[model samples]
Target: MKKLRDGPMDGDMNGNQRTHNFRFLLALAILTPLVVSMTVMGLATFHFGRLSVGELTGTIVQQTVARVGAQLKQLQDVAQDQNRLNLKVMADRPPRAGDFKRVAAALAPSFEVNDELDGVYYGVEATGEFFALLRGTNQVVNLLERTLDPDGQWSRRISRWSGTDWQFLEQLPADRYDPRTRPFYQAAKTARATIWTSTYEFWPHRPGDRRTTGVTCATPVYDGAGQLQGVWGVDLGTIELCDYLAAIDPEVPGYPFIVGEEGDGTRRVIAHPNRNMVIDARTGMLFRDANGIRDETVKAFLRQIPGRFAAHAVHTASHTVPLRLSEFAPDSVAARTRTFEFADHGTNYLGGCFVTGRDDRLLIGMVLDKKEVMRHVNRNAAWFAATFAAVLVASLIGVFGFARRASRPLVELQREAHAVGRLELAPSDPPLSHIREIRELGNAMALMKTNLRSFRKYVPADLVGDLVRSGQEAMLGGERINATIYFSDIAGFTPVAEQLRPEEIVEHLGAYLQAMSDGIAQHSGTVDKYIGDAVMAFWNAPRPNPAHAADACRAALANQRQLDRLNEQWRAAGKPVFRTRIGLHTGPVVVGNIGSEHRMNYTVIGDTVNLASRLENLNKLYGTRILISETTRAEAGSAISARPVDRANIKGKTTVVTVYELLCEAEAETPEQAELRRQTEEAFAFYQRGDYARAAAAYREILQRWPADGVAAALLRRCEELAAKAPPPLSQDG
Candidate 1:
């Protein structure tokens, strides 16, 4: 006599936990040896394979170093290409004072796309003038323009973009900084091609403030006549290079650095993995202070190398070898494309170097601690041995425990099925199972029980039982049965969705749908589908409901009442209220499962379904909530109050059908509602009879009483148009 509930299973099954545990223990005993054997084989391969573990580790380090070098070269190439393109665009026309803003706007896109570009500038050789746009922290963009005034001193103006437009920040007094004197300008002007400046401190905002190490990519600008107009340059920050390396593999015990040859041929650290090493702490600037070179690992390595190369020296030997500037000479080992191992601080390390830039003055290198690089491999080997033993023990315990818990649900399901076979429709809940197959079986059994109890809501309970007992399948074909179809839509739902946030829309729509579904279920109706804020349903499908029309009418009425209560609650909470409209039609239509084999929906469809949908839309025209066809009104009898609204051939149909507005429940109609319905019907009747003047008078009266009555207003407008039109074109044709 136990009944099922909605949710997970209720009670434990007959099998004891100890019995299932024993089964699991037996399974674990069978699997443990296979797992251990696999682990041992893998460890043996690592220890004595053709490719030794050390070689594999070394290959990985070499590949990583190569990738880092490639990325740095690619970055520089992008900067060069960007500068060359900008210079071409700017030099297309002669440099003019008025064209500075337009040129900067053109270059803005390049800066925006390349996050590493610190700034872009154009210098004019014809005039002592320079224009630049710099990107600052937190999305701040600053424009700097240096111009020579009548007094022969440089004036600088700074401006910032204020989202919509540019706003002038300040104008500084004359300064001596000239773009022609800068290294980037001189190099590009001399080469007449793209060139990279040596890394230096770039502190454009305020002197002695925060400084960052960066290099500039510059290209000479030429006018149409082939005259050197000026130099165009882009500053690229090296901090991004450090960040790029840090993000490569933080868990690895290695670092990357870029060393470039100084003007004096001495190698200087340009980009370091530890950014602070290249930054001068005193001024917070990069490569500005000599003390900044202290503690820099690559510089330290270079310093240890003797000034002169020893003859026949073994540079590739594992023993510590000094890395001097001479080793980076054209044919030295440090400049060659290879990796070497050396000892540093009693720890063996591996270093690989690659030449970068067209000038071959830059070496991109990575140094990894030998012990740290092997740490993971060594730890993994130890973990493999310990884990195999522990897994062997734990598997036996876990399998036994899991087997006991997993079997209980299947046992309980069997008992429930037995009870169901004996005509005992009600049975205790099946136990939940964690195993996939067992859970699926439990779910099937639960679905069977639910169908047995709730089938009457969808079809006649007696017929369902008969089909089950006879073991016969319901045929796929539908029958022409007199049934009532209902459709409801929330008004202004699109706007409502637009106004509410995503979560709020979900919450409000959920509550609205649940309220409507509950109302339909209360009247023994079957919900077909929900399309957004609309619901479609029907009654008397597989079941013979003699009062299906009345039932649908009652459900629609109850649905409105539920919405009214919800609207009241929403209004009190300062939330928007949803107004719903319902349309109902009763007719002989095909009702059955209709769709492809993979997916089928047991619903009603035909001209009757379309009519119901159209009727729902008609509510908007009449300014009413619910509308029904003449057939539904007749079948519904006096249980519901309705008034004739209009008769028209709806779209996709040739025959005209009469439609009525559902006023309310017969007993719940207010006196004022009754009076409104009477007046509306009277006006509609007068308009239909071709009494234009009287109809207009009647509609006017109705509008005076209910100014918002859309139907009345429409009819009144039609009557006025008819009266205003001259006698007729028919008389002229005659």
Candidate 2:
């Protein structure tokens, strides 16, 4: 029509051009709905294609890390627990060569080797057999002993004749337990720790013919002279531990796997899906591979593997690629390997090595990506998707009444997609869509993009966000954080519990945790976890707490204040009130979710937890309300009100981590109490430094002034004894 206005064939041409433009606009109107529908479908595909798998894998990895960390920590706990008992034993009586029997007897109740026993046993290099406590009975069982010798591997069996209680006997070469040479013996003897040994002989062939085995945990025992004595420890059967650990993923149908490397055979399947496939879970006994199983399938997977391992590694570097087996998916999706699992059969090629430790041998491997065990089903789903798309496209051509209605839904979906594509994390409060599914999807997308802003209130939003993107962050695992630990418990809770109804008890406990949690948070601390009525909190993790020590001290004081207030209220209501004892410590610990995938917890662990608990209980001795470790006092400087209580070792820790009392703002007698603390510190230091004369004089003056000082009394008695004995420069050197 405009061209006609330039002077040729005017009216008719103008009408024709107008008609054409109207048709073009109609076409655009129809195309708008189709384009939007396709865009919405594309967005959904993105989620299905990549995000879903990534989310699932991330969740699994987090859980796996947490579970593995916990299991290893439990092993550490068992070692430390036994070490404590051994320490007590050494303190009570010197280690004599003949004390092995008594020691083994003492370990009988908890050291059994059965399904429930969990491969708990102690071994001594002086003796030629490994020791186990019989299940449900306090009987010492010898796994490999010269007493049952004059035989070979399979000849060994469980017998009651060996002792008044059940005993197991297996024989092996003499050097395996020669106190002078065994790996377990050597490691324990060298340090005051339950040391893990390198890979050696894992299974004993006979009762007396002791052979080498894989890694073990050995805790040393000392005699009165502090001379090196035999070791009390636990031996882990790689096969057995692997089998039990393999059961961790029981929801999946296939057998779990543990892969390790024995010296002679480099590429072998150490443990497999079938419990009896290669070795017995209980005894590590060799079993025949049953017929009619998937031998080809197993071999096929193994054959597909590629390896350049640092031998075997549990803590493999991120860049390290072990035997990578493929699930052989078609090139329809952008995925190669979805998961990693260890071979279950005896000594498979894909094995985990405890690279973090001395030995470079495979301990075990897990079967990863079991959800896709049935590829056929996944392939069918893919095919069904493709067919559905074809039908959808063809239906667009029909343009029937129902088609338009269905297409209308797709049309609206497309419009929302375009709107989302235009919108971003800008601060505008855009109109939220009315459609429920659309609104939810849009919100989810927005949340993902703005997670840093959303979770900022609960966590240090920026740091956690970066960690998530880098895939270095884990929801279920814990890190070894530099933490100021705080433990607070209801002081007279036992008697209080007896007095209250069950519901009331529960109510009180709930109130206690909630109050503790709020206080800890306000001071920038995380509740590491709770133990019954006790609350354990920490600072400097999941967020930066620069004033962690100061905050920890403040929190302790706050809890005491809160508890005092709560009790006051309770007493006013005619309900009995209880006291709370708080303990704090600063140290490095392995913190994480301390449980399995299905059932897990975010918590902290190590000797730190034990020491903190010990500190809480030690309030009984000091008559102080709250106690902090010497480390915490040093870090807290003047911000925390504390006085060193002692330089003595706790029940678990080998090194003495001195503890102190934390004074609060509300105590008016704090200055006078602090002066008394100063005097006590000087007196204790004098005694510790071997100036017994000055120490005794100071102690006597303190007792005269404060008759109720128990520490002063005990120190006075010790000082007098030191006055009689040789007053060396200092006390015992640990």
Candidate 3:
């Protein structure tokens, strides 16, 4: 018994596996039930709470949609009803043709009463006579009337109403101004009833006046004798509608807009909180395409409108059909309110759409971000979670204080291991523990951190960190992926290296490499390797980047900017300036840790890498600073400015590749640089078409404008040589 007690239950062995097992089991047993019960209860509460919140938010959105619909109806109905009233009154007692005074007096009260009315007009179908009263600048009444001039020809006169009299503003030359040819006039005459016209840009009263998009409500009036007399119309532009929608609580509850749909399945934004968003400056018409919209939020909403509305469409036995505005009855409760949900740019949104004007096929829509709706619920949930966590922690602390003390060193070692896994090797002291295994774990983590710190210098820290965090082992294999490869080299680097001392060369080259590496890393690019003065980098590897090409181009431009600053400093010190050239190409390549099992490199390899290297060499022949493959130029899109350089067959590649000289970021380029690029591209096009003479002339023009343009000079010499080798054109005498 004495031998067994001394051998097995000794003090030294107590701190071994038994102590660790006891501490771990004790803590796990005590904390399991407490943590599990609290987590389950919290999840149950959150699930039910979220359901209740969603229902409440849906109701709020429905009400908001109804309110917006009501407001739109009130605005649109005024003009329609006014046109009907004018038709009825005029039909009761037909007015004579060209009775401008009586028509203006009759329409003045209705037009002035409603601030939404942009204008009111009367047209005599029989005599081709017309008169219009419009709310001009500052709400001042303006008139456009057709009258006989002294030359006995019809002329349109523009005048401002001075409350009691009309003061002439400007007179337009006679061009047979006839309202009978207008769309509203013809539609009203054909229907012989009140109807709404499609939106159109109203002609500005003055040359510099802003144009506005408006719709007209037109109705034909007949004489008591049953003879056709004339048509009366009322105009309503989007200005008032935009202002009313803008006045709504746009930031918190929802953003409101009005969309108009035509019978032919065309949709347009008629009114928005941002008035300018709906108005197309180029055509002065309503925005029909969501792509042309400047506001990102509005564009996103418009893009989702079609899909969301189609999804909620009333389904039939045979096919699913979207609910159209024209299908809704004017006064139907269903027409006045409906709610739906959609996601835009990863954010969920709740919205309401209701038919505001069936005749005009307009629907009022309000979009509310889900984040805003759930904000209060989230805040309350956070408070409840915090309170519950605080109580649970307080209870567990007292119950497990002794167990926690026994295991604190192991916990510290676990944290150290996690830190090392993240490649956060900023020198930390190893945790001291009485337990043998715990001390061993801490030492292992310290040594790993030290090794990774040195390993990061050879391999990219990001690549290694990603591999470690994902728990993936570095293996000798790769996968084909679309990536952008970048290569850069200093111009005349060999000669420059020879001129400087070994230490001086190292200092300058070291700073240059560091700056280039930093620029690449800043754009999520991995530095594959450094070949003397040349550095090769790649993007969309280890981490996926959808915009890898653009990122690479931006990094190249940034590196150039960085070199400019360095050169300024070097110039002040009378040191040799190192002009660097960059090349970028985007294509599918094999990227991963590629080497034997014992030694591996996280790099890319393929024809794309070779082409990128070739492009850097071509920059010297073209006298350009940066050249990129056509694939890279296309992937980068309009974010970077580049001009076509030339097409050449890459070594070992059967197909010819087009190249472009990357200038600078599109937004950063000056007008002069843009012009130079434009001329160079134009000349290159001529050269490609075998018009060497014209190409030479274009290059000469470019040189005249930019005297120090080396690219123009080089291309001009090439054009002259090609032109001299060409056979003379056949004489016209033949």
Strongest candidate by lDDT? 3
lDDT of 3 by residue, 142-174 (tens): 777876656667877887776666688888766
Per-residue lDDT of candidate 1, residues 253-369 (tens digit): 777676666655655566676777765667655664223475545654454442321211334323221222333344443324456676655767776665544345566666777
Candidate 3 clashing pairs?
none
Give the Å error, residue 606, model 2. 1.9
- Give, for candidate 2, the lowest lDDT window spanning 10 residues: 325-334
Give candidate 1's TM-score: 0.45
Segments of candidate 2 deviating more than 4 angstroms? 1-436, 439-478, 597-599, 665-670, 720-734
Best by TM-score: 3
Q: Which of candidates 1 and 2 reaches a greater TM-score? A: 1
Residue lDDT tens for model 2, 1-734: 12212123323633654332333344456656765776577557644745455354433443443344345445445545655665565455544434535555555544542342323444444434444433223433443222324454322234332444435443334443343466667767776656766445544434543332345667766556776545665555444554555556534323334344434534444445454455444444433221222334454444434452243233322322222111111221112112344444442222112222234333323333434533433564576667657755664554443333343444644554444344323432323555566567556655654654464444333344445545563457767777788888877778888988999989978887788788887888887667788887777876667779888888888877888899899889998776888888888888665677676555678877778888988888767678888888888876755656677678877787777767654334476777778888888788767788898999998889888876677678878888888545544673
Clashes of each: 1, 53, 0
